[model samples]
Target: MLKKQFKTTRVFRFKRFARKSYSVFNSLHKTVTIGVLSGCALISAHATTVEPAERVYTQTSTDSIPPTELDEVVVTASKVDLPLNLAAKQVTVISRQEIERAPVRSIEDLLNYVAGVDILQRGPHGVQADISLRGGSFDQTAILLNGVNLTNPHTGHYSFDIPINLSDIERIEIVQGPSSLVFGASAFSGGVNIITRKDPESNGFAKLEGGMYGLFGAEARGAYKTENSLHSLSAGYKHSDGYIANSDYNIVNLLWQSRFDINGSNLDVMAGLNDKKQGANTFYSAAHPNQFDDTQGIFASIRGETGGRLKFIPHIYWSRHYDEFQLYRDGTPDIPATYKGHNYHRSDVFGMNLNMQYASRWGITSFGGEFRNEGIMSNVLGKPMDDTIGKYTKSDSRTNISYFLEHNFIFNRFTLSVGGLLNYNTAVVDKFNLYPALNASYRPSKSLKLYASWNKATRMPTFTDLYYTTSTHTGNSNLEAETSEAFETGLKYIHPVIKGSIAAFYMKGRNMIDWVKTSSDALWESRNHTKINTKGLDATLGLDLKEWFGANQPFHSFSMGFMVLDQNMVESGLISNYVLNPLHYKFTAALHHDVLKNLSLSWNFRWQEREGSYVQYVDSQPGERVDFTPFSLLDVKASYRFPHVDLFVNANNIFNTTHVDFGNIPQPGFWLSGGASIRF
Candidate 1:
């Protein structure tokens, strides 16, 4: 039996922004204050922000899918979601079916194909990857889980330490631009939101896999349904001996989700955990080949909506992350005298947000606010502590309060939206700052739309950037927040036979943060660099051959994307760890075709040229600087479908190409993997 979603209903609405009547405004204000403080969860009517979006990617052993409708897809970066056709920002989506058919395994790998998004991996299989958007550094993007911020206060490098199993993801959506005016700080460059919605059509699935380097794994997911409630569970564990010495990893993930109907409102609750242990050879510094890392993350959240004309959405979440890193392996033959004890850190985040909307003849007005507290306890990253918890002996904490209000006006084929976020952070001097945004879209025809956007954003320094101390690196607690003002313009065309989009963006940044050293002999220090300006362009085109010509066409679909980026920064005899090694040029292409009725093949090709250079470290010491080298990779996947079972085989880096994504870190070569799954 398949379960269906339950929705609430709104029968009335006022025309203004909470000022229908003075008394009503006061009552609503009191209600909202209580909701935000007491951690209440609410959901709008039938269709609210982030409505369930289930998309199909292929036609193997299943009925054919209908063509995509532009108006049917919505962007949820704001309190009031808008259709993609009328949106001023561009969003890239990776559907569940696409993930199932891709040659990639980890979420990090899947994001590599995106044009402006970069995933620099320190280890394979989602062990540790730094995610960046546009030409910004990894920490500039806001990482979210089901719309709840999951960013780590310790460092952005651990932002991908998600607790949910890979199989539990419903979709991954990327908004490739600053959303500080929309989703608040750390979305300075972009936002990546992972949604794990329950699938009523799927009773459950189980799978097993094995590959190179003695890799093996098993995973299972199940969904149960009742009249007014649904429950889901997912769990997975994998381990390998590693492709090289000390590169092995073991990972375990577990997640559970439940939803219930309370009167005319909807209630959602979820919890998950992810534990990973891996060798971090050359992950941070290449000076030691025996470096290792272990991390455990736990998170839980609740959200829902309740209201009549004034739709209110309340969200509350909590997450804790524990991380331990070793500069030298525990069993190292000889430890350097400069090597201090291992680094141990713990980060905790608790947050609550209240969003409300009112629709009237005047347009749609949305207002919301969020309260968040992020704290870290670390041996090497924060201020000294009076007491110790386990191995941690230092601590620091900060609170951020953000409020937002926006008005959306739609006149025929034209749409305009203006909003801003009033933000105040305890770590940033406790002063309020306003980040304003303006978005407009014009549709001259049914197939073509032009959009433009302008916004300002800022991101706070992480614990590691603030107070970390070591032999090779030192932090600055006086470092100011990084800020940027960006502008973007783009055009998109949608058709049954062909779909294409082109966009260009420019950003002026101030107080940019980076770890730099005057020379190899000096310790790396975190500093706020001078003004840096960035500009970039990206274009994509896709063709559906089967729809354009006939069903007998040899190829089912083909798509390609290209991107170019430029940034200006120069200093005499200065060495930078990040910000310099960005993608200068990137190209990606994918092709899918049906070899047989039940057999399908997908081919993926990517080429990228990186900028800047990295210093080579040897034997626990910094050596000479090495220039980056460009690399190309090809991957392939084949899938065969049966009545109730699906079998797949994939090969990554099939041509045995050697590459380096970060400083002195060598990437894997050719690898082959296969898997089988049974679906009920």
Candidate 2:
């Protein structure tokens, strides 16, 4: 049998009235806050602290090596441009070369190769991917685009599906460990910052690509540069019929960035907008796969920078997201025989972020602050007022503010940095949340380095966990925020040919939140358990063998990387009904070679194995069962490039492995996709 849920006649009218009133109030409040904050920040800059940002590498090169020897790779790790080798933390860079050489179709595909990270996929394409760092859950991590936070409001468990394509990205930065001290909420796990490409040519370029699975895409960019100013604009769109049932997606994005020199200082402004629509597959069902889940959203951000001794960066953004999915019975097919039920949710967020830094000969210091107002509306089961068996209208809103301070001190052969964060959260229906953290790093020698950090992070309860009420799932209003105290230490070694690093970490969490069946009732309720811990080690060794490929022709380059991760839960409780523990190992290799005078070939290979654990679930006998299984996957890609066009092909699950990756969900085996991009 099927069921349907809808908004009540009077409630619909009330919603509109409330929205109008709220908008007016929001505008007035925002204007006043912005003005006051800007004034206070300007005044504070006079006595600003000094802090150096982490460094990143956009290209491959050395600092002292003249331009004749190599090209410099500049990064914003320390908030200032610096060489990659001098970065304070473990930094991973995914260059444009790497993007073009892989079969990556989504953000998950682009990040799956990184060590100490886990990507849980519901299937291929934009369906669903739970990205975790160091055993942290999806809600623990923070996702950013162009340095702006993009965490979804409906559920912290999901992030804004990457708006741009592989071709649109210039590079990706993955900083592991607790970064909330630097980036604010949702950075409890780690942080992923995606930087898009700027216009590359004065004459402009247009690109078109097509491939299997109903995939096709295009991008256009142009730029103008003069003595005092440079202006650029770019736009791109992509669409595809995903690899799974009811999985289809489309995305469009536009970006504008400009820089102007005023007197001795400089000004930078960047603005972007994105709209995406993707399927969710069968999120809550194993009986039927065709229930067709859908997600649609729009996001925009604008920021300005002042290039001064005391640098000032301020930005603001807005996001509107709406998602809906259908529910069906086990015996039913993809097409619903009757109206089972539906879940509809909408979320909107308005936020402001500001950062400042003071630099001198000695070192640099930095401080930043953030404020956000978030609102939510949903048509889940059981809210305030409704009468459809188990249907209701849900709504909640809240605001949060956070601030951070840090300093970087540089010496002859070593560098040290320390930082801390303070957060204040106010919700309309619950108690306030306060979070704090501290981190530091040290370099013992050029070839050897050590790092350590500690943090107190909090993960707020999800919307579904706190407000949902249905036949299959129940919600608890009385829930506390989950908190964690983490500590980590690591070592790094850099050699001329072989470079690698190792890190070990331990994190203990209390009031861990999960759902468990009630003893008296047949419904599930949210509860907190004490003492849940995660401990693991991460290691990576990549050997560069350009000399082995050829003496000095710029003919070839090869590198290989390997990683392993183990995660477990130490606390015992019935509410902990997920994959209790997971073990994973992965290896990847890349080879780039010149095929002809103006042609090059790049080949990439990746293999991964995952050891799964038990998930609490009711079986056919209505008894709980434990599942222990193993799954593996292999992926490969080859690319050939010329002056006008670049040809590429990717093969996923090359071995055609038929074993199930998702417990009850069936997935296609051995899929292929190929495409080409033409540029002028």
Candidate 3:
């Protein structure tokens, strides 16, 4: 009888959502027609002002022998900088050129195509998303902006609330595998660092865009540069009525960055803010459909460095986050006015770091220490109290101090690094802990390199994981810290026309954390599970078509990547909630071609398959477990460049495939967007 009811519920849910999605798509079709017409009119008006330039390519002579070349990329995964081929860890770098060419609206969209990264997006244009790496949970991945850690202590879900506009980024660096030795905690899987543009060049751009679902946005950036000083400012705003009800959003971002050379020291300062308000249809609970959220974040950092054989860098950073959540847009009469079933949370983090590096004939040595404090004030997520003041219930704070040391030995053709970190946390039962790492790289030839690494890392529970409580969910403050040991090895090849890498990794986790429920009707409870094991493989291949075919080919570039992951639970009698989110396999491919002297076309494709199924509960009914079938998506972009302006159009999910990423939340299809940018 229960099985029959579950099946009936699943069918009804699928049909209901599917019908709504089709309606949204039909509305988008009309919007797309109007947007295209407007875009064409704007382009025609500007067509007489500028002339298109011929496409140019640098040609290399095949008749002459090329000189030996070392890798030009400087990797920052280690505390110190090293060449890409010489760095022991696996690193992927996305340059500004690539970012500009991709048909993506957000950083999360760009990362979704990477080999080992997993992006679970709940909304469009990075309104909300969760990022994971190598089968690790979202909380295990550390996020950094210009080397400043930005992992939120409140929840990892907000890690994507970055302030800098995509246009302001110079490059993105992804370091895969454990990195606790350098970054301390919450880097059990790896780290992602967004490096902002700091080149001393006087340049800027203004952009305007419109798309389906009432999406519209404007962005502007300006930079002033001199021989010894540089300053940059950027601002952007985006609004969308959404493809469906209760999914609309508006976002605003502002940033300022500056650098100055004072005597012999280099000083840098940065400040940014991001504000967002959105309707959350099924973001948290499906039972309450009229959910809404408003969030704001402010971040600032100052850093200075002095150079010598013995160099020193000192930096300090501060971040504040405010969040307000409403389960229902309208209040219920039964609920108390004092509580109102609304949640308000504020979190602040401040930290200071001092790092010293010494370079000798033998090798390079690096040492660093950090002190950080995190505090939170909440209305409904902490301890309950009788004397409530203005909807305030609880406040909590914690401090952490950490120190690390690393030494790199550079041989004629090999490099080896050893590092360790000691950390103390005031909130943890075991206040003191140590993590260590060892990595090695061997370069037999300029075109080929091999690397291997082993590391141990740990992560502390977030405030939401330790103290959050609600009618449908609960947290446990007694949960222990999660730890993991990871091992990885890879081979890389680089040539004039071809570049690629393949890596395999395994991780063993102890005291793994997860949210679980005993039955469909039970409330979700956070706990530290006994054990988990994960293994994965990542591979990427790229080809410069023009170079590969002797510079005469019409096509410019082609690239593809593939990843496979497997995870297992070693403990008995345990049910997992988030642990089963990893994909079984993922594949991505892209191609670019020049269609005319000033016109180009780019296309990207992705295929993904999840490991298993997820069970979603409907009010009072036995939930049905449904599997996310294999799905494929395709995106295409076309751009025309003129003397002073560039115009582009992007079509995403061109095939309009119906798919669900999480639960019954239907993803948008057949999205069309167009934009123009003017540079000075």
lDDT of each: 0.77, 0.58, 0.75
The ten-residue window of minimal lDDT in model 1 covers: 5-14
Question: How do the residues 1-680 of candidate 1 rate in per-residue lDDT, one tens digit apiece?
Answer: 11221111011112112223323344455445446543653321111335443221111111111112234345665556655665656777776766777787788998887776778888878878998787888888888877778888889999998876667777787888788866667788888888785767788889898999988888899999998998999989888888878999999989888876554445678888999999988787777788999999999877765443355677788999999898887999878787768999999998877777775445567887888899999888788889888888899999888888887765557777888888899987749999998888888987898989988999999898999778778999999999999999999898879989999999888888888888778888998888778899999888988998899866888888999998887552467777766788999998989898889999988999988787877775788887888899999999999999989898999999989888778888998989998998
Q: Each model's TM-score?
A: 0.91, 0.79, 0.87
lDDT for 96 in candidate 1 is 75
Measure candidate 1: CA RMSD: 6.0
Candidate 2 residue 175 Cα shift, in angstroms, is: 1.3
Best candidate, TM-score-wise?
1
Q: In lDDT terms, which candidate is top?
A: 1
- TM-score, candidate 3, is 0.87
Worst 10 residues of 3 by lDDT: 43-52
Candidate 2: lDDT of 24?
36
Top-down lDDT ranking: 1, 3, 2
Q: How close is candidate 2 to the true structure, as a TM-score?
A: 0.79
